[model samples]
Target: MTLTHRLLSPLIVALAFSAPVVTHAATDPSFVLTATSKNFDNYFPSYLANGYFSTMTSVRGSEANLAYMVAFMDYAKDDIARPAAIPGWSGIDYSTGKSTAGEFWLNRTLLSDKAFSDYQQTLDMHNGTLTTRYRYTDDSQKSTRIEITTFVSQADTHLAATRITITPEFDGSVQLSFPLNIWAPHQPRFPIGKMTGDEMLAAVAANNMSVTEPVNYRTADRAPVWYHGDTNVSNDDGSTKDLTLQLDGKAEQGLHMAEAAAIELPKGIKPSDITLDKSTYQLALNMKVPVHKGHAYSFTKYVAMSRESWGGDASATAALAKKARSTGFDKLLAAHQTAWHTLWQSDIVIDGDAKVQQAVHSDLYYLLSNSTSGTAWPMGACALTPNYAGHAFWDSDSWVFPALLLLHPDRAKPIVMFRHRTMQPARERAIQYGAKGTMYPWEADPETGIDYTPHFAYGVFREIHVNADVAIAQWQYYLASGDSAWLKANGWPVIKEVADFWVSRVSYDKANDRYEILHVTSPDEAYDDVPNDSFTNAAARKALDIATAAATKVGASPDPQWADISKKMYIPFDAKARRHLDFDASVPHDKITWMGSSLAWLMYPNLDLPMSPEIRKNDFDFQLEELKVHGNDPNEMMMVMLATAAAEVGDGKTAGEWLQRNLVGFLKPPYNVRSETASNNAGYILATSAGFVQSLVYGLSGLRIDDNGLTEAYAPALPPTWKSLTLKHITFRGKRYDITVDRDAAGNAKLTRKAL
Candidate 1:
């Protein structure tokens, strides 16, 4: 389907979208997100990622000035424990800090100093390529048109390339200098504190506080720079320098990272002509471009970033850059395009609404950009950025995994593999907490499965739902893929351990004859230290049930206690209101906070709880009213979930309205990328993106995944303004299918499924 729609809402359309100038006619105009060089600044960043590595640039022409790259594997130890500091509760390092993998850029000051005109940057969402074009005129009025095409190769995960082509009106030299630097920005280790910045600095100067030392270079010269530092520091009270102490390490101690670039010069320029400028933590490649009038000179720079976590050494990383340089740019571009094309095969097609189609594609595109097969690390909240300290939470299992599992199961493996890889740590954590089974942390360390939740947050000790969340994600993957080997090897163990954790956690109330999980935080995160949270109990019950069945699948004896616990699990409900209570003690029909309500999970993703239409409607209505309240900030994921709930409750108008509000409120153009909150707090939230896509695929299509396999739970509710919604290449049980939902002549929603 051709994507050619204007924004549905005029108020939400960005300035770039309103007057889009497609400088590249060969590329699809609908897939291209374009903005002027002036649109970019320190605050407004434009970025590209290829699952392995990502680069963020401030402007159109170069990756200079406030530009950096982050590899998925690059992480440093968070400031948790040190010799002089108050001992951290968890002895292990969280390793949640996402240090800069590398930075490579042409000298922006030198290039932008010359007079330039018609500068524009366009990101092709369909092909995963970014192209920037401009014409520079010298003092003699001689013009040179320069076009730079950049892409992190999806085909070859470790390789990234930038192709620079220049055509000049006069024969002259264009000096080009490229620098590679590996560094991270300075920020407080503990961000939340009561003390003033100046006071904290004074305390540090007075030897009352301590900070992580600066990074020390181990290897630096003409080759890739390798460095590490000590993150351990002295602790302070919540009111003091703990929040003021700046973390100085660029790379973590155990994470071996090496980055270098190889330049493929034009035919006339010799390799030996380029000069190398070296520093302690940086390397520069300097040369001059020999420009001939009306003769185009093309040069490609290949960058390779390797980390020990992702299976690469210094020699291997350098060899990758060299190999990519030898392979040439055209072949690499073609391979990258092919990889993207394969991913786009499983796409959401919205008929009669071009803007919605574009938005959906952009969301899926970003998720795909941040994923790859055979990796055990979870995608962070801000997929490529260091926002939220790059920690993976329940967001990965509950929101992000579903969409990927349905569309691209191979890519979805990492989300579950990460859990399996960290299960040992989960067991160790449970032992430390005096619990029987595995307990996944609320906020996990990417490298080691350490509980990264700060000691102050109750989630560090009380939020236990992540265990079940991980188990449910694993079972869902099994249901979708039907991979028996994976079930026995990776899936069953996690599921069984989660069941064991719940077994050890619940209290046996013989008087009430029920199993109760006490003092836990639900997905809502508002009601802490509560008993029997509706979502938590339901999820845990479902995990137990899955474990019982998985035992049979893996040819292991079923744990009898799992069935008993699941059968007697006490889920909070208000009989009079006919709605599941947020927690056992939550008052029915009380004034509610405008934040997200976890009750929606029962209707959308889980579907394990037994609820009548009246109950679902009551809960959804109450939550929707809470979201509508003006003062509180409601996240985008819940809005998407509520929209799906609206559809399930036969409220098509409400569903359509909420979906529209989400598109307008959370997603920003010209790229239609989603921020964490409606207030534009954090950019490129993959959870929000995943939830939006899930709302369309599973919500609008009425498809539900369970042990019985993929089945339509009910008739889909088509959005009022939508002509039709079709999901292509939906893989279930190793078969691909296309499902389309549209209104029949009678104005009733109809769903058609075709096997491919």
Candidate 2:
């Protein structure tokens, strides 16, 4: 087998979403943001991302989302989201465990005022590179321009470096203050980072961050300067004075945070020169570089962010930042950019449609930034964002993984590898649940594999299909990578444990020969703990089939019952509705709606059952009608899944519309995607990016793979308005290829390729 796989499609090509709701709504959109024509001022973002970690700036042009220094904040500290626990760090004293709770939030503004909210700012982002032009005023009424160029270090996945060039119009120095976190207006707890003086101060000095770059410090070069604020600042919104550590007795409360800070600055700019006052909890940065008027003096800083929730100590994280700074920002930035450029092997060219092209590029950018070849830990459900606490959920396996597998299977490998690494916890959880096999947590973080869903939270905890999700992902990885060795070494163990869980979990009825899963939550959370969910049953059965087949392929001993159970699994369907039953035939399908209730995933991404145009149409119609009442908050994935289903029904117009609906509203300026209002929420954009590409793969292109190889290929669902759609540098199995469809009256649209 030379891996010469091809899917024949119409000689034409075209493509596609993520969203948060603000007061912005418009008619059907014709364009999305692109590389050149964006106003970065609206969002104030630029990044250095490496799948699991990102070092970024907020709209106000200050450091944000790194270790989530603060949770959700606003001018009024009324309601704030609590901190979540990363591997080395924990969330702000939370109790529950699901993404909604006990998740780290990374939202903070080192300097914010209602007045500065409208300051002049410009940002330019392309792939892993970002340049921010921030213009603000100082106390001397001098216009200060902060040019912050940021990139996540590819050489060190744990660090992101920023080069700050500041040119002040006058000779006066500005004072930077750290304020108590403000509460969000809409919700009691906004999904943001939160840290008081003690935690922030201890985090730096406890880990020796102050000396992380002493050499750089001594030479009048750049050094990392750290800051943790005191809770007793005079100003509530952090707009006023104070950098001197207040020796007034209260400083002892933070005495333990006694080490130096990790805030990076130029060597000539010493803290003692600018120290007005400081408390152990909170301190300010006040430095004058003799930086008088007109000279642009730039300082670079590095921050180390681990993939785990938190590092064991400060040095573990600070040393990483120090090494990156030592490497110099230019070298790290170039390496980061080059690393991203190399991995951007697969791309789509939508000729004559810049918005679609830019949207696709933006989607691909996030997917690329949030992933690499060997680890799944950083590609959290909300990668590098504090909102989801950098946790992996079913989203990795179901939504994000499949798309990566299509174009970059190598990048998708860590999903399987990470799961294998965490299987022991699954086994332990299975034991706790009194089940025979592994039970994967619905929301996973490295600190504790124990299900983080709040205890007794039946809705997500009862969602046993997470185990099946991992199994399917393993099988899919094997199919895509064709790595038999990996299958034996890592894949088999997970599949076997999943099998152990399923066989024990399934209830066999003596009166009937069918096996059924009981009291389980399928994709639809609305129908919590329902029996025989169509997707769940079908997935378990497929898992069994994959396990048995994979065992033989990899020369492993098989469980005889695996085949029997898969063969006898019961999947309920409604003949009258002509759609798979939400629970059983008795339950009204119209009453259910969730991310999974869109129902087309089983046919497209899951490939659990074959669906013809008629069935696919019927299901899509049923979901739309049902959703009029039962719909949950509009999600990015649901929109993408519906697009997939729509394209399957030969409705490229409908498919394109579904994706556009998200792009116009869900995405902000510069095309950043939001997922369920979480931080770094960009990972949610994977759905839109994957939807566009997968709609081509599974919808328009009708691509499929099985043991026999290239099992199915059909015509493309090219939108009438587009000129062409191309997926180049597609890595399928061990071979590289391209898929292109062009709008033409004549000439073949075959993709001819060798190497790139």
Candidate 2: misplaced stretches above 4 Å? 1-48, 63-124, 171-279, 282-286, 304-326, 376-378, 576-578, 590-598, 629-633, 677-693, 744-756
Question: What is the C-alpha lDDT profile of model 1 across 1-756, one tens digit per residue?
Answer: 000000000111222333345656775565777766444332245467777667764344455322222332333353421111111110000011112532222332233434556777777888888787787654445566878888888898777777777787766555555555433323333322233334433333343123255321110010110111222211111101111111112243334445546667788764323555444433455554456688887777677765555546445666777788789999999999999998989989987666667777888888998877887878766675554445577778888899899899888889999999999889998998878779998777666767655333434367787888899999999999899999999999999998999999999999999999988866565556778887888888999999999999999998899999999999888788788777886533243433546678788774446678788889887676656652156667778888788888877777777778777757665566686556533466788889888888888787789877898886798877888899999899989999899999998889998999
Estimate the overall C-alpha local distance difference test score of candidate 1. 0.66
lDDT for every model?
A: 0.66, 0.53
* Candidate 1 displacement at residue 652 in angstroms: 2.8
Number of colliding residue pairs in each model: 1, 64
Off by over 4 Å in 1: 1-28, 37-43, 65-116, 137-143, 184-250, 270-273, 309-311, 586-596, 629-631
lDDT of 2 by residue, 1-756 (tens): 000000000011011212211111331122223222123223424344666444444544444333322111111232121122121110111001113222221123223332132333322233354554445543323455656555665555656655667666666443332211221212222211244323423332433444555321112111011111121122211112222111111111211111111234565664334433333333333343355677676665455543223232344544555556567767777786566556655666665565666666666667777776654342555454443334566767876787788688877787778788888889988898889778898766533343444222335657777788889889888888788888899999999999989998999977888898888776766676678888888888888888898889888888999999988998887788677666776555555243436465566665546666677678788676666667744455567677777766667678778766656544545445543311113233344555555665666555666676544444456666766677778776788777666654553233223454
Q: Kindly provide the TM-score of model 1 when superposed on the true structure, using C-alpha atoms.
A: 0.83
